[model samples]
Every structure is written in C-alpha cells, then in structure tokens.
Target: MATDDIKDTVEYSEDVKVDEKQNISQHEGIPRPEDLKQDMALQTGEADHELRERERKLLWKIDLRLLPTLSVMYLLASLDRGNIGNARLGGLEADLHLEGNDFYNALSIFYAGYVLCQIPSNLMVKTMRPSRWIGITMTLWGVCSTCMAATKNASGLFAARFFLGCFETGIGPSAPLILSFWYRREEMSSRLAVFLGSSTVAGAFGGALAYAVLGHLQGAQGLSAWRWLFIIEGLPTICLGLLAFVILPDYPASAGKRWLSPEEKELAIQRGASAFNTDTSNFDLRQVKAALLDYKNWLTALVYTGLNAPLASFTSFLPTIVKTLGFTNLQAQLLTIPPYIAACFYLGIMCYLSDKLKQRALFIIIVSMTGTLGYMFLLIGNNVALQYLGACFAAMGLYPLIPLTLSWISNNQLGHSKRAVALAMANTMSQTLSVLGTQIYKTQDAPAYRPGHAICLAFTCLTWGTALVLRYFLKKENASKDKQYGVPGEIDEKHFVGAEDMYDKHPGFRYIL
Candidate 1:
C-alpha cells in the first residue's frame, strides 16, 4: 500500500464509530441501519482518497514550517555547546590559565546544571507556550555562550559554561517532546533525525568556521582566536531565538489558526488523539508516577546512559582526538569535518530505514555494535590511517543512536505527561553519566588515549547488551497482550474513552518493537 493509503486506513479505522454516527444522523430514520451501513461503504473509498490528499498537503505544510526552524535552532545549540572543543585548540586553555584537570572540570560542570534542569525544563515546555519557553531559554543560553569569550580565568569559564548548560537544557532535551506534540509515532524517527542531525552539521560547520576564525581573525583586534570563535558562533543564536517566538507553532489545537483551515485543524487534533492518550489532564501527577514506575523507562535510560558517555566523549573530544593523529591544530580542525559529513549521510539512511521498517531496537543494536567496532580499532590500531578509520566508524555508529533511542522511548509511552517525564527522566540519567564522559579523556592520556577508547568501547557494548534485553522484554509483553486481547482489531474512537488513565495498559495499545 502507498504511505498515504496506510495512513488513511489507520485514521478511518479509528474514526469508524464517528462515521457511523454521521451516517445514521443523515438518514433521519428514513432507512434501516443496514441501509446506512451500505451507503457508508459506498462512500468510503472516495472519502478516503479526498482525506488522504488533504492529509498529504497538511503534512507537507507542517514539515516545511517546523523542521527547518527546529533544525537551525538545534544546529546553533550544538555549535555553542561543542565549539568549546574547537576553541580549546585555538589556545582557550593557555589564555584562561586552565591547567591539568581544570579544562575537564570546565567541561563537566556544564552537565551539573544540565542534569538538574532536564525534567523541569521539559515540563515547562508542556505548560508554557512552546515558542515563548524555547525562545527565552535560547536567548539566555546565547548570552551565556557569548560571555565565554570574556572569561579571564577558569572560574569565569566554569560559571559561563554552567549557566549555558542550564539554559540549553530547554532546547536539546525539550525538542523531541515538542516534536512528539506535532507528529505520530511512525513519523517521529525521520523528523527527529532531521532535528538531531543538525548536531552533525554543527560539527562540520564549526570546524570550517573555526579554521577560518583561528587562521585569519586571531589577533585582528587583540582578542585570541578562541575568543573570536565564541563571539562569532554565539551571536547568531540570539537572533534565531528571538525569531522562534514569531515563527514557531504551538500545539495543533491552537497552531496555524491564521494558516490552517478549520477542517485542517480538526484533522491535526485527531491525528494527535489517534497517536496519544489525550483524555488525561495535561499535567497529571499520576502520569509522572506511572512514568517513574515503568520498567521500560529505566531500561531505555540505561541504553541512553550507555550511549551518552561515548557521545559526550566524542563531541567534546573528537577534535582533540583527531589532533593526536599527527595533525597540526588547523589541520585537526579541518579534518574533523569529513567524519561528521559522513555521519550525516549515514544517519539519514538509517533513520529512513528505521521509520520505513517501523523498527527501533534492532537498528539501535546494529549501530551500537558498529560503535563497538569503531572503538576497538581506535584502542589498538597501529597506524594513524587505521585510527582515522575508527573515527569515521565511531561517528557513523554513535550519531544515529541518539534519535533512535529518543524516539523509541517516546513511541512506547502513551500519555503526554508520561512521555514528557519519561523523556526527561531518561535524559537526566544519561546526562549524569555524561559528566563522567567528559573526564575520561584525560590530558595526560592523549597521544593514545587508550583508556578513554577502552571505556567508550565498553559503553558501546553495554548499549548493545541492554538493547537486546529491552527488546526481549518488549517482544514478550507484546506476545502477552496478543494472547490476552486475542489480537487487536481496527481501532475506533469509542475504544479511547477513559483509556488515557490506563495508558499503555489499554488493551488496544501495542508497543512498537
């Protein structure tokens, strides 16, 4: 079946009772119910085609409006966060008087605020207008990031980075939650790949930008090249944040009032209702309790933790790691670009296949093993060429897991509140480990960084193992549901009445394994 046809079938099935009601009311008791059913059957094919066309247009409009704005916001966020690594090579450490472990401490302290704010920031995104909340946070973080250029010592850098993390938590962790509000589970992975893929672009763009700034602008006006890097990268984020308030849409119920027709708005809301348990209160504490208790949340959080340690080490240390491969400072910065570009292509392909197959855990396992192999090469490779190959493998393997795991956790949860908490909870656990990830690549350990490679390798292996166990449990539960429910039929709106409270416990709901 065509993609639009499948979507039409799902929506039609879910709305069958409503269609029946409309059919019966139109008959006005002039005909028997059987006649109404016959008439409805005749009309169904044409109705499906018309609705599918409208829906296809609606999706295109939404994709155009949402994806680019969110992608650019995330790109700026990634640059501000990761540019510190680029700055490090441009003499940030020497100028700031950072010595020994002070540089690592600077890197790790950002996550202190990051970990603390995950749950609260995500909840705020739920309660406040998403545009306002995200815009305000973006502006604040931009300010904090720009201020890093002014830091005269390790203390100043620590304060700047810590605040930057606090504000940035609103963007990185909150984006998937925001996207969940607009998209269905089947549609999420690819959309999220676009959003998360910005970080890869940031990696590539930051390198080229750093090379230019560090080469030509270093001492043009008495500021170091690293300071100029922070200034140049941080200023554009402020402008984009302000623009978000004007461009970013809120929830579908209220979004596009000026643009979407009433029918389109109704369709959007129904789309959200079909995918999520929408009967519950928006901020129910009970949902929070349910999310905290769900074993799936913890299992996925473990997988996230495993991925983040390596992710943290990779993003912050990739330049440094590349530098150790017998390249000059400028050359190291330039060389980091290709791996990220390769990862971007790799991520797009994997995410497309993931969404097309409607599978998450299997792809996650594949990439985790790929990452394991990457680290194995890095750990023991004898030549610089072999080690560089490891870097490409590591980038390819690690980048896609982020969107996959995030969407998987989001896909399985039912209520909005529960999903919000689950997303934040998983990120909270994973980010805590990221603090340790920052410190693993010690300064003294460089020029080989064997222990760092080994630890990351172990974490990737852990990701693979945990994903296997989680998939097993999810498959088993799906089996239990099929047995108890005797296989689910086409969903109808009637099935959702009072079902929000039951969440994933609802008999009609099935985990997407």
Candidate 2:
C-alpha cells in the first residue's frame, strides 16, 4: 500500500513487489533473478558477515535488556491463564457449587475466544505499535484476572474467562513480530526459545508464587486465598504493561533512541536492507495463498497439535497430575515447580545450542524422543520418584519444541505482512488444538487415565512421524529447486541450516520443513 516510490540501491529496489489482489503480508513477494544477480554482486562477504555479526550482537544485547522484562510480562499472563487451576486447588468449584465439570467448561470457553483472535489480532498489530498493543492487552487481562477474585458462581467465572481471552488476545502472536524486528530468521530459534521459555519459567515460578500467596494469604480480610492469588498475580502485569511501553524496541530500522552507535545502527539497517534482496515484500493475495497453501504449514500444525494434548495435560493440570502420586495439593504445587525449573534449564541450554549450530530440526528430534520416553514411563511404570522424574523429562521436552518450531516458521517466512499473518495463523492453529486437549482428559479419566495416557503416547509418535516426514520433505524440496535454481558456487550448498538463512536473503524462499 505504501509503494509510492522505490528506494533504489546499487541494484535492487526497496519497494518489494506485490499484487494487491491476493491476501498475505505486504512484506514478502516475488523478486526477479536478474535483480538478485546484480544485487548479489554488490554483497561483500567481508562486509556482510561483519555487519551481520555486529547486528546480531546488538539484537543479542537487546534481548539481555528485553527478555527479562518480556519473560516477566508473559510469566504474569500465563499465571493468569492457569490461575484457575490454582483456584481449583483452593476450592473455586465448591464455592460456586458447580455441577458436572462446569469448571472445565469455563476453561474450554476461554479458548473459544482465543481461537478467534490469532489472525485479526496480528493484522492489527502490524498496523499499530506492538508495545502499545501488548501493553493494552496486558492491562485488560489484569483487570479480568482481578475481577475473578470477586466471582460468585460458575456464570461469573465463565464471563471472566471469556473476557480474559478477549483481553489477552494480541500478546502471543504479536510477540514474534517484535522479535522479528531485531533478529534475522537464523537467530530466531534461540530468541524464540527465550520468549516461549518464559512459559516454563512461569509454570514453575507461578506454583511457588501461588504456594506462598495461597498458603499465607488464605484468610486476608474476607477474601479466599485464591482471590488473593488473582489480585496479587494480576497487579504486577499492570506495572509491566507500563514498563513495556517505555522499553521495548519496535523495529530495527524505525527503532527509537540512539541505543547503538550510528555505525552499529547502520549495520542493523544494512542487514535488513540486504535481506530484502532475498526476502523483502509487498503483501498480496497470491503470496498469501502461497503461504497458506504450502504443505509445511499443515505438517507443522499437525506436529504442534499432536504435542498439544500431552503438553496441556502437563502444563494445565500438572499439580493435579502430580497429586495422583499421593502428594497434598500444596506438595503437588511445590513438586510442579521442579519440573518446570528443569524445563527452563533445558530450554535455555538447548536454545543456546540451536543458535550456536543454527540447526533446528536436529534439536526437534532429540527433544521429541526424550519427551516420548518420559510420557511412556508415566503411562506404564509406577515408582513415585521415577514417575515424578518423568514429569521433569516431560517439562524439559515440551519447552524447547515451541521456540524451535516457532523459529522454524518465523525465520522461513519472508516479509513483515506475510510473517505476521502466517505467524498468527500458525499460532492460532496450534492453540486451537488446546480446545480438544483440555476436554480430552476428563476428571473421570484421571488417576491412571489410561485413555488420556494412550492419547498422549500416540501424539508423541505423531511428532516423530511428522519430524521424519519434514526431514524428507525438506530435502526433496531443496533438491528439486536446486536443480532449477542452482548456480555453480553461488553460495554454500554442502550444508543446510534449517531453511532460515538460505531464504531470509532470497524471496525464492521456499519452505523446506
């Protein structure tokens, strides 16, 4: 829409081409090879890699400042999402005098709203500032969570849950858009890990926070401890919303402040500018269809969905899941902390390695297999520590996949518009599965939960099967294109790094996995 004039460099034009007829992010589109041939001639190896390294450091440092704040923000949001679980432990169901799984019905209803938000919310995010949008959502969800403190019955709880979903809509998908502002596709895996890893951090820390608040604040004034949990947990997010407005960087080219020296800032611009040679955009319907129609989108969706049942079962109900091991709710909540702690450790380390190696699928393979084994042990074995240790394994397994999977998707997508829409769609489809997952493990099916356990086991196998298909599919796709698109010694082809760097610079960017 903004392509009034092209910003011409030595060989390529800055206005990425897109046909308005089709729908997709205005960020990616078809580029002519003749244009790229000229552009590639200008790309200096010494200069490009040097500049890339510099920007990488800048973005890395940005995360050092950014991750803690965002991690804390997301931690607060996630705690609110699951606080209902905490409330159950403190007797929310009985207080409302709900009948026949009405509490779970409330959980399912929230996701109904969450399901509608993915694409539209991100589209709005592209139009607005992410810091502003996310902060607003944060404040709204905080209000919703706080209101939960006053809920009198199941109807009140249901209304709170729906509004909670509505208020919290934009934060998740929009987060990737912010991350893309700084990091290149290749760097996304680890950065994504840092972002999503907060879930693990939150899961563990929330339990501790709940344990402390619910334990000590049980009878404050006329409120129940669960109400206090909502109040205390929801309030910090308000402060965090204000903080994000002040601190989060919007985009590399348009970033406010002189945080980096001019030369360093130039490097950030040049890297993004150079990246346009391969992967810049003008959003349109054809490319949008291209993105949505691609096979990887559905394959990736299936992998994520397959993992969802197990992941939510563990993440949403871990304290209750642990209670089956004969621990009190307090002990169960305390024990839940350790697995998520272990998960955080594994997440940080694995993500670091993913960055260092620039390999995503390899790590996906390992984490999936490890998680499968953990779930298997839970399904059949009975030793308490061993079953509990399976939980640590379970925690470690799920945390890393999300970051890498998201990185894989985000990095491969070419432009801002395409990235935003696809990121939202991909994310929506993934969370859409939560609707099924939450309902699958009915309370009647608890304890051994043979059916639920069997279902999770099958899902792990789905992840593995999906991985195998992806590995083969990517290789085949790359090989066929290489036959047509290959040039002798144009770029390194001997080794592949998870499809990000290869396409981040080229619009011919086809999804490999």
> Which one wins on TM-score?
1
TM-score of 1: 0.92
Residue 228 local lDDT, model 2: 92
TM-score of each: 0.92, 0.84
| lDDT of candidate 2 over 220-301, digit per residue (tens) | 8988898898898888877778777777766665565557676766666655543332233333454456667767767777
The residue ranges of model 1 lying beyond 4 angstroms of the native Cα positions read 1-42, 277-281
* Residue-level lDDT tens digits of model 1 in 201-278: 999999999999999998978999899999999999999999989999878887766878899888888888878647
Question: Which of the numbered candidates is closest to the native, going by highest lDDT?
Answer: 1
